[model samples]
Target chain A: MITKDELLQIIYKAVADFNSMQDVDEQLAQQANQVLFSRPGFTKEGLLDSMGLVNFLVTLDDWLDQQESAQSLHFDISDALENKEEALLTIDSLANYILLKNKKV
Target chain B: MSIKNSHILILSDTNQSNFSSYLSKYIKDAKVVTTPFNQLMQVLINPTHAVWQQHYALIIFWANPKSLFPDLEKTLIGKHEMLHVKNFFLRLIDKAERVLFTGFENYPNGFYSQFENISSHNRYALNMMLTSISMESPGVVSYLPGYYSPVVKGLHAVSEDLWYLSKTAWHRTVTDRMASFVADMWKQWHGLSVKLIITDLDDTLWGGIVGDDGWEQLRLGGHDAVGESFSDTQQQLLIWKKRGILLAIASKNDEETALQAIDRHPEMKLRKADFSTWRINWEDKALNIQSIITELNIGAQHTLFMDDNPVERYRVAQAFPDMIVPNLPANKLEVPAFLRSLSCIPATGVLTNEDMHRAELYVAEQQRKNSMTAFSGIDEWIQSLNTVVSIEKLSHQNLTRAAQLLNKTNQMNLRTRRLSEDALWNWSQTPGQAFYTAHVHDKFGDAGLTGLIGVSIHDDELFVEDFVLSCRVMGRGIEETLMNFIISLMTEWQLSNVKVACLLTPKNKPCRDFFSRYLLSDSHEWVFDSKARFVVSGIQCNVIDFN
Candidate 1:
């Protein structure tokens, strides 16, 4: 099961101008937490779970690719994800995997 | 920070501010050279010493770029310059793993217009040709549309859309069509199919069961609504048999009654000879399925089981779940659509000679299966085919098909390796690396690009870095031909040692028997002792040299 907070983090990474992880986390916490956001108990750990992360990463990937500016931000998260047995199991995992496989990591 | 950094060697006028800030932020290792674009020809003249030091992963040229083009006055000159740039681009692609051509002049249509006016159908055609060429040759191209403001620097990066507009429709249709075309070709190329379809012979093939209805009352074939529908459906199944997809009977009925029904019925499209296998016994569905899979030398996954009985469908689904057991349509009217849906996988692009002989080859395989009952030894079984091996060097066209086989093939594959379109070109364009893939053809038919081997030459030694064969042709001495062919090349090259390694994968156990004779062990062992052993092989074989 996925939580709202993880979904928010994925969206944040994809769209937000926030440069740091802390900024991303804050935006997620604020945007999430309400049951209206879909899926209750919106915790960070719930968001990072395998299925949750994959959905998050796919959304983030599409958002990043759509951005017209900021060619400098590297989307290299592959090496960290490659350690997993199934390379595409999670959102963060896939985002990282694509980055590394393309040598962006 | 590490991710953002790229070692870029830009040969643009440094005075330009367009992508400088963006490059600084995105790329960690930036070597912004002030040299003009034309000066790049001078820089690459002494590639080994001068350009080697830069160790640039990518190079960008930032300018009004139109300034370099003195005029489009002489259309021929512009064309010649484009050709020169294209050739130079190819050379760069061969040298570098990845290359991008961006920052054409800032005019709205300036970038695309140059290539568009140069006698091509559309921008996409030119772009796809270039992209496919780069893809085939181990490089890629990207364009950077100019940035209007500092805030949106590096905003208009060239990717698939800007590079080629026509690819969207071409890829969608091409990929879908290609999949089915490849599937059909695979059936023909292999020659032998699963021994039987083992379909239920009642409402499954026709509108009614013969056991329940009298022969005259039973519906099948030609005129009068449902009868014609049954005839059309039965003819479609016959099409499968003509392609060497064998039919089988697994009807739950008295043997005499079923035989009589098939023999006496006027509308029946399928005759007695159409079935090479049958299981019309009053046994459990599970037992019949197991027998069919065993007798066919096929897995349940390869078999397509059809039955009209809901209880039977459920039982078979539970018993042999791997078999393709499509549900009987709820409407019963949409049966043809349901059947056609199964033909979705493609069967085109590249086909081996064996593909044309597939149906006949399957018939031959049946003969072999029967002869096996009389013959005792493995040698006798193999000797019957008078098998031939044709090994060849990888050419420009077969590369895509060869790499595809390498990616999908398992069971007999030595190392379960997966390579992308880009990586295959990298191997081809990389200097001193001899990439060879083989196509196997015998008495049956041509199995196109069945084997692939990648050899890298370092110093004077030849190395078998990667080798794999399609599992479909495994058991036949195809492995022997591959290894011996490599050794022949090693001998011709005058290399003392031919280094080989078999990377282990669970499904690749068949390769263990292969390396036993050639590599001396089923484990990993590096054969090269020194750099002198790394030499290119000049050996040739008459077996697969068609050209």
Candidate 2:
């Protein structure tokens, strides 16, 4: 399970990391999330619509790939974000997603 | 830097050959992952594919022709593709360093159509949008027009023309226009102001050697024919001087002859008064240029040197690669047009008060130097001008100048980090971000927006992320005023142990000594916490109102 806030944190960090950002602390990270998510529902897709999300995701993926003994997994977090069917959405979900996918090996 | 950890994910359907493999050979840092073109939406949605994001620095998005537009079943011509491709480019402009347009090699029949379509009226709008984005962000979006490469010959048709025409039109076009435009989209980028135009007097400015030919016989100053062309060039140079470009002449001739021709010749437009410096000596031209650069306290890149003599031009070019050496036409008739193009048209915006006072400022500097030679102490020199510092919290009015200072102020810049307008806007929106501008004025002139600093607060720790001051205002005690102001702000807020870090840059050695100089504080790279110490000095006086 991954919550929107957690997903956003990862996304924000990813974007910052991709940019070689040195001092994007929690405060700036929160603002970045707000900027992307603050708009009305109409612009929610706009937040992740263009290169911003792509760059962020790409950066996150690169960092994760650098981890020793990297793992890959699939976990359905859409249920948590969209349906609100699950309450747990944190950095743990991201870790578990990789763990679960690697379990197939 | 080996890109071993990097990966590139290409989303394309064409089986023409694995372009990813081709890219892989060139780019070895990241593994290349090529997925079938239509699977974009699915791949993005798939949580498993997130691995691609973690492994790659770049994502080459090759649009799948089939899934993107199903209605156009037949091979879409370049125009039709471009109409759609334009949307695709706009969509991805935010993500990539540059988007390379390709298709001519594989599909030549439709290439011209795509090129023409992209070059149509919509091209201007696209260029405008790209330029607008560049203005806003810096280094974030660049479109490699399809015509840039033979295999991808479409959008570049216009860009190439635009690049060439800008020079022909006598406009100071953007340098590294497309790449810089994109880089500017994400960061603040700077351009050198062509302040001083240094020229040779004999063949460069007018036709004849004044030392040998004398005023009357010297092929200058007349409406007859060749002399008329010489006067035209002089008039153009005079126009530039009036517009605030500093004019200087370095001629190896008897100074009296030049004075006589300029003073007595009826057709002469450029006179002795127009030049800021006249190095009319038999010394080496290169040495004279070196003296000019030192006297102005500007970089070689900011000076444009012109000489009709090929050997002289070669000598200067070899010595200073950065100095602009426009080709001097062999024929005198072409001199006027060449000089006309050499005139600097100031950046596309309104001129500032400081810009208008630049000539006065330089003159004041000369006066200050002459006084310094007569004065006994350094303090006497500084005190002579009655310098005053005025600090103002950042505002919209001076944001552009603030950005300029952050990007261009090198020697005294602490952290030496360049930021884009979008980044600044984002920072303003962020919590705990503080920005301020400082203006210094003395008896000489107003050094406008002389300094800028950006600070961020996290928990109890305050971070001085950027501190920069313009070179023009460096010698004055402005930095002390800025540091004192920062400490005063912290005292007012009751914040403790304020930490300031100075990042090393190619041109920022002066900044490394900042804290040590005025504050007598130690700096370290460890994550700054509340325990850090910043001793505040209590000496203040004479605050001038610059607002």
**Top TM-score model:** 2
Please give each candidate's TM-score.
0.50, 0.57
lDDT tens digits, residue span B121-231, model 2: 444444444455445433444333342342222222222221122211001111112222222221212434576789998866677787888777767655567878877
Q: Write the per-residue lDDT of candidate 1 for residues B310-332, one digit (tens) a residue.
A: 89888888888767677867544
User: Candidate 1 lDDT (Cα, whole model)?
Assistant: 0.52
Could you tell me the lDDT of residue B431 within candidate 2? 67
lDDT of 1 at B320: 82
Q: For model 1, what is the error of residue B311's alpha carbon versus the real structure, in angstroms, after optimal superposition?
A: 1.8
Going through the candidates in order, their DockQ values are 0.04, 0.01
lDDT of each: 0.52, 0.55
Model 2 residue runs over 4 Å out of place are A1-105, B1-189, B215-225, B231-245, B259-273, B336-357, B514-547
Model 2 TM-score relative to the real fold: 0.57
Candidate closest to the true structure, highest lDDT? 2
Candidates' interface RMSDs, in order?
15.3, 17.6
The DockQ score of candidate 1 comes to 0.04
- Per-residue lDDT tens digits for candidate 2, residues A1-105, read 434454445545655554432212322233432433222444433333222322233345544444433323233333223322121222333344444444654
